[model samples]
Target: MSAKLYLYPGWLRLWHFSNAILCLILIVTGLSMQYTTQGDSMISFQLAVSLHNICGVIFVFNYVIYFIGNMVTTNGKFYWRNWGGFFKQAITQSRYYLYGNFKGESCPFQVNEEVKFNPLQKIAYVAIMYVMVPLVMLSGIAMLYPDIIIPELNGISGMFLTDLAHIISGFVISIFLLIHIYFCTFGTSATSNFKSIVSGYHD
Candidate 1:
């Protein structure tokens, strides 16, 4: 029998759903802006820009909630790296995903309050949360006020660099979303992970 654990907190669920919705809005509007022509766009260029900016602002607030909540709660420990045997643990986890799991081997890591993530998950989440998300946020802000931070280098404006960074970061985050969804299916049931987030219980 699988054990049920109270893994998610109410605040986290709120922040998570908020972030997910905002991300969907941003992604749709962003792609529309990128590939849509003026006459046949799904959303008008102006409307897309407005929605992206609005959702981005809301996402910032949700991100702040997540960051602060983690810092103030024991949940923060979930992302911490134990330096001892870190590499070995990471390699084992990678092997489980790549080879062992296909052979019916059990996972090397299991979720608990103190150790919620495997080594590989810890690293990926840390990079995505602390590095990529922040980079994307800052770049998006910079794009809004190009006049204040304009630095021309080799005939390229700083605005171009900021936009490039924002686009690349968004793309990386989108890819992460796909991988994350795939892993969610590894739970006891296909929707187990998702249900855990919604109901605060993991089986």
Candidate 2:
């Protein structure tokens, strides 16, 4: 039986929903800009640039709220768990993803009030949220204000390096978002996770 838990608060849900929309817009605009050549692109280069900048700025603020919310609320605890035995737990969870899940074996780690995320999920979330997101944001800021970037970074144009970093990190986040949506389908029912995000309860 699935236990119902009020895991997502109203503010958290709003942040998540807005974050999803902004990320989609940013990713689309980013791709348009990246692929533009001689004024040919999915979206006009000028419009793509404008939308990307607008959404990027909004994402910055939204990320700040997420960081602060994690710090000041219990939500942060899930991501802040001790790393002891993490590798072992991660391996077990990985095995489930690779083998056990296909065999209809129950998950090695189940969600509860104290531990809402499995080991691999927690690690991925930490790395993506704490590390990759910040990297992307900093590189994005540098691109927006070229004047801030040093003229040369290790004999290469700083702007080039900044753009590269931004692209790579953005790509990582885009991939994560896709995988996250796929994983959300794993629940009591195919739509249960989606409904939980809307109603702020996990079943």
Candidate 3:
């Protein structure tokens, strides 16, 4: 039998579930606004805009809770890493995903009580949560309040730049979420990690 670890707490699970729901809503609405021609959208333009704004605000608040939770909880420790030989460790993990796993070899970095994320996961999480999130939020806020952004940036519309940034960052986050779900299946069983997120235990 595989070992079990009580890694996820109640608050964390709530945050994860809520965040996932909010992100999905935002993705759908955002796509409707961006890609749909008037009268040809799955969601009406006005309704999509409203839903997108509401979910965006809620997501921002959820992210704030996540930030504070990380600050006060031991869970935050997993995101930090020693820079020494980090790339090599990430490469090993990559090899495991690309080749070793196909050969039925064990993972190079196993999840444990002290280490929840492997090297690549740590790197990806840090970039997404810290860099991309902030960029997207700031850009989104600027877009929401157009006056906050300079009227013209190098003769280009400031709102245009802000919107572009928000779209790109949001796209990156969406891609990350898909990959995250894919990786969740790499646990002991195909559903083990999904169960862990819900039950607060990692198998």
Candidate 4:
């Protein structure tokens, strides 16, 4: 029998929704600023900058809450990698996604109280949350206060480097968001996982 479980708590729901909104805002404004010239932009360049910075600050605050919540709550357990047989588990999970699922085979990983993410998810989340997000935030901060927070190499200006880093990281995160959304649809139904985040239950 299929078991329904309380997978997402209220605080996590709040964080997830808030973060998603802020991310959407940031991505929109950021891309607007990057691609459009000042006079030809959809939103004014100044407005885009303002929106991006504001959303970025809010996103950082939300990220802090997410970090602290994970540290203090059971949610963190999902992210902790099981080093023992990690590669094997990851391979199995990858195979399921790439081949097994197409052949009508069952998934190798299942969600439960102690293990929320599969091996591949754990690795991807770790890299995204711990590495890419931090770098993006740091580079953004450097962009905001280029003089005070110089992140330069030998002779290159920190502002230029930081801008490049921020752009690349944001692109990577954007791609990840697409992939994440696609995978979320792979649940029991197309919207099951989406509904779970809203209602805090998973079946």
**Where's the lowest-lDDT run of ten residues in candidate 1?**
75-84
Provide the TM-score for each candidate, comma-separated: 0.94, 0.96, 0.97, 0.95
Q: Which residue pairs of candidate 4 clash? A: none
Tell me the tens digit of each residue's lDDT in model 1 across 38-90.
59888999999999989988888888999999999877878774657988999
What digit string (tens of lDDT, one per residue) describes model 4 on residues 1-203?
Answer: 68888999999999999988888888899999889885767888888899999888888888899999999988887887465799999999999999999998877888877778888878888989988899898888777777775656788977787888999999898988898889898787789999999999986
Clashing pairs in 3: none
The CA lDDT at 105 in model 4 is: 85
Candidates' C-alpha lDDT: 0.86, 0.92, 0.91, 0.87
Measured on C-alpha atoms, candidate 2 has an lDDT of 0.92
Candidate 2 residue pairs in backbone clash: none
Q: Rank the candidates by lDDT, best first.
A: 2, 3, 4, 1
Worst 10 residues of 4 by lDDT: 144-153
lDDT of 3 by residue, 21-106 (tens): 99999899998999989566789999999999888888899999999999899989999745578989999999999999999999
Task: Pick the winner on lDDT between candidates 3 and 4.
Answer: 3
After TM-score superposition, the amount by which residue 80's alpha carbon in candidate 1 deviates from its true location, in angstroms, is 1.9
Question: Top model by lDDT, which number?
Answer: 2
Query: How accurate locally is residue 43 in candidate 3, as Cα lDDT from 0 to 100?
Result: 94
Which candidate wins on TM-score?
3
